[model samples]
Target chain A: YREFYQCDVDVIGSKSQVNELELVQIVDKVFGLLDVNVLVKINNRKVLTGFAEICGFPDKVVDITVAIDKLDKIGLESVEEEMREKGLTDGAIAVIEQILKLSGSTSEKLASMRSLMNGGSASGLVSETGLKGLDELEELFGLIDAAGVKCPVEIDLSLARGLNYYTGAIFEVKAVDFQIGSICGGGRYDNLTGIFGLPDMSGVGISFGADRIYDVLKGLDKFPKSLASSTTLLFACMGAEELRYVLPVAAALRSEGVSVEVYPEPSKLKKQFDYAEKKSIPFLSINGGNEAEAGTIQLKNLTTGEQKSFSKADISGMKAFMNM
Target chain B: YREFYQCDVDVIGSKSQVNELELVQIVDKVFGLLDVNVLVKINNRKVLTGFAEICGFPDKVVDITVAIDKLDKIGLESVEEEMREKGLTDGAIAVIEQILKLSGSTSEKLASMRSLMNGGSASGLVSETGLKGLDELEELFGLIDAAGVKCPVEIDLSLARGLNYYTGAIFEVKAVDFQIGSICGGGRYDNLTGIFGLPDMSGVGISFGADRIYDVLKGLDKFPKSLASSTTLLFACMGAEELRYVLPVAAALRSEGVSVEVYPEPSKLKKQFDYAEKKSIPFLSINGGNEAEAGTIQLKNLTTGEQKSFSKADISGMKAFMNM
Candidate 1:
């Protein structure tokens, strides 16, 4: 099996707008450069918690949420069965089923939730957290709308990311064309630091699933050619002296932003050509005894088998030709 | 623990100067953009294989290699025991041990290996493939010399990446200041596609250990400041009608690349101010009936508690202020 690596950028110690904006902006810039279109969906746990409280399911909050979060994966029936198995009252399960089934524009869904909760002993149990959650949603959407970022920002209440530490906005980005699970996801966990004995600190961050993205990009053949290049030229030498003589010329080209490499051994020209062909190297520099003595180099195009001789002191045109 | 992502890019089919050069170039660009200095090391397995064959223990090649590969992790004693356990003769083990201890520049090490391997049953057994490896190494170094790339690239035989697929060049990059493991590493594997029924197709690749790099960057506080932004401004409203008036203006500023958010409720000004403070929003827009009708906004700087009035059309300046 192959293993990949990850790099997580996070903001901890505050749940302020600056922290959230900062994280999202970085996400935007990094992925933006990679030319991936992403839909960033955000939600808050307090909203879900409030929905639970208002549904007369205060005690079964975790159980109800944990099951409902799997709505997309296991479907509604399994979630309801899970709720029933978790000892939720029939009324509570019924309400949860209704909530889980609730879908519409985000505002419409919230409106429906509000109407459902506007009843019984659970009235107003959606309480401050849920109400604040609703307000936060409105504000967040307002911010997103106001930002006019090209990437779609959706308010997804059902996006109950499985983690227990999320307190405020939870974010996940999905590529429009790929579906190997989320390409990037993260959230604001207000109490993660509490585990380390530092309470009440909040943090938000995202992890880009690099391996999966790589697979996705590779499968789609989306890697930019520029990202895969090593060198633009290779020097095929016939001897150590030739290699030594041509080193400075290659060095000068390299200093001028051309990537140059010289073959170390004085091997057969065909063998050197084989090496160049296999690595996808585009250009080959041939500087045998004659070329060395004349202070000239023959640049051969590995791809097209084209060759041109260049004076040692002036190879700018050759550099451009090699780049192509 | 936080997780980042990693991707390994490999190219197989040819072990030439082009392939090795491409490897180094890709390494330079990616790591260069990331502002990470890496030590790219190259090694040839053919040399090691030559040592194994000339040691009179050709059958124990894999065992010898596997043991020696663990030298950095478990030390020489463990490798010796591993060879002993694999039934290598004492004489062969001594020969292998002597070759393993070869030190100095790469050519010097190669010289020593050749000296030890000469006059044995395996004499001249290290022919074309082995010689080709040395030639490849020289070509690789020649290319690197020619390129004059700023990143440090070295040749070390001890870096036997634990795999048999490598037919030509192998590479590993280690970050100097980080306490973590190899930040990046990969090599040319000639037979990777052989498992997929495409033998002899050589491929070279490198993988960046993004997660470890992220940890190191985070630990070093190397993240740029702009990455942590959330909303640029919070539009505090006097009432529902006031919010309606602010929406279009918010949208306009958003269109101009400013992240603007509006309060959902007509909360007290103090409460709104506290919210702005909590969110770390630097600017707040307060639209009273007068300002709303006048098509102007009263902008309050939360950090300095400074207020300024701007006409609706003048909001594009927010983008410049934030990005600049």
Candidate 2:
């Protein structure tokens, strides 16, 4: 439900190297943070349009592309069957099957596409639109190489993204180690806002499927340990009077950027200690009549079971002791 | 859209001092951060129920409460009119008006409610349920005082929250200086999930109206300046070769927790610097043929307009220079 409209020409140009590198860098940083292997598959919608022209069904481009997008889930035969059901001729289906079977290094696939668009084997189907698509792909690959993106990428010719609004390059990211579908995707759209009466503004952006990414991370057990808890210290008082005495200390610690909580009412010692344990709080500050009257606080390292007493005035020292 | 099931009795108990203190502490911290004056109004649905019983129309409690919730928006006369239309007696409406007009300091209002419930002047309306509700309110106020909650509070008997599900304490937070509706509110719901077949579970929670809070902050110009841009550095290279050379440097900076971007296709110096300016990137690193051959980088501070050269190995120093 979130949308970004970028009208900056340098970054939103359909085939700009600046846009490509920025995207690759983002992919690199995201995967680097997740510590997950990913493959960034890229293709151009123009190429698909040219492909439909060469299939002799330029008018049925949307129908063909929609069916082709389900190839991954339904298999090639099912896609071919669906296209045929959509009124595509046997010749068009065969041409699509040949394109789907394309596999090799990115450059090798680009070369194959170039030959196909040059009318080397397919005559009367190659068009200037098809050639232009190949040229854009070649330039994109060159910039990707110059940018030195670490993630593996391929010129996935069969990747026909479902949306019909994309007018140029399309990008999709897949987790290499997980079976979840594309975790991120977006593409260039020339004049997407034109339909809203603001014409000639082009833009491109990517959206991470956050829920699916969460699922992937959870399934892989890749979440970082630091996200476990927000509370770091608990004040375990012994009585109502002790609680009142500890309130200012808790407030001071909180102001010093330490997450601190005071047990509201004095309960059983075991129950208070168990509360600290269950919350995984690393430090516990306890104060009773004796400590309160002495103007001091008893600090206990919950993890180490070490206890010490500090003067209440030594707030800075207590913060350092608790590593706040 | 978020649902939390709290089965722990200690934290979820509606009358528990621990739970009340925790909520008050949280409210204090949040309002402290927002730096806005707020009034935290508290009432118990049980108290409203008692009010209905005292009005001699226990069965019409829901109808009366719903109408009372719109008191602020439609004034007292309209509320009385609506109640009359809903079949309340003229005597009952007059009594309700007396209750609604009872307003003063929180303690003074609580005293007035006690006398009213004790049948001082309006006799034979007080019930055991009403007494119990008053006792709970007294205990909650005592706990709030001990917890040292900083926000102002009021005991307005007319404050009937709209929801019928709240069985105990209801809280509504309002910004004193802003015209927006409640910025946050929540209440205790007893056995809400019992309809789904699980019984005897109680929970209480508060939800901050984040969108309204954001609007308030924007209108007040209270957002921190650091939120303007996430990127701190931009590497402006001279060519594809320079981009390749700067890629690792950018990666290293990113690994060190600095947000950095490199000019993708090495355009004019002016264009790259313009990109940096537009993005609000504070630092720009330029390494052309001379600096590249010397294994050095020219860093420009966009904010201070200070330019200096640093050895390529001084990445740690560069990070320190940018205060990242």
> Best candidate, TM-score-wise?
2
- Candidate 2, residues A169-288, lDDT tens digits: the string is 788889999998888887778888788887887777777777777878988889875566567888986876777678777777777788887775678889889988887878888888
Rate residue B272 of model 2 by lDDT.
88
**Number of backbone collisions per candidate, in order?**
33, 0
Structural similarity of chain A in candidate 1, as TM-score: 0.86
Query: Least accurate stretch of 10 residues (summed lDDT) in model 1 chain B?
Result: B119-128
Among residues 3 or more apart in sequence or in different chains, the pairs in candidate 2 whose N, CA or C atoms overlap within 3 Å are none
Q: State every prediction's TM-score relative to the real structure.
A: 0.54, 0.63
DockQ of each candidate's interface versus the true one? 0.10, 0.19
Please report the TM-score between candidate 1 and the true structure: 0.54
Deviating ranges (above 4 Å) for candidate 1 = A1-4, A114-125, A293-295, B1-324
Per-residue lDDT tens digits for candidate 1, residues B1-324, read: 256677877655545555567678778766776677677888877756665677666666577777777888898878888888999877777776776676787567655655555543323444344555666777677766665567888776567666566666778888766667677777777678888999877777887777887877786677654455488889886875676577667666755567777675577889988988877788888888998789787877777776777787776555544442
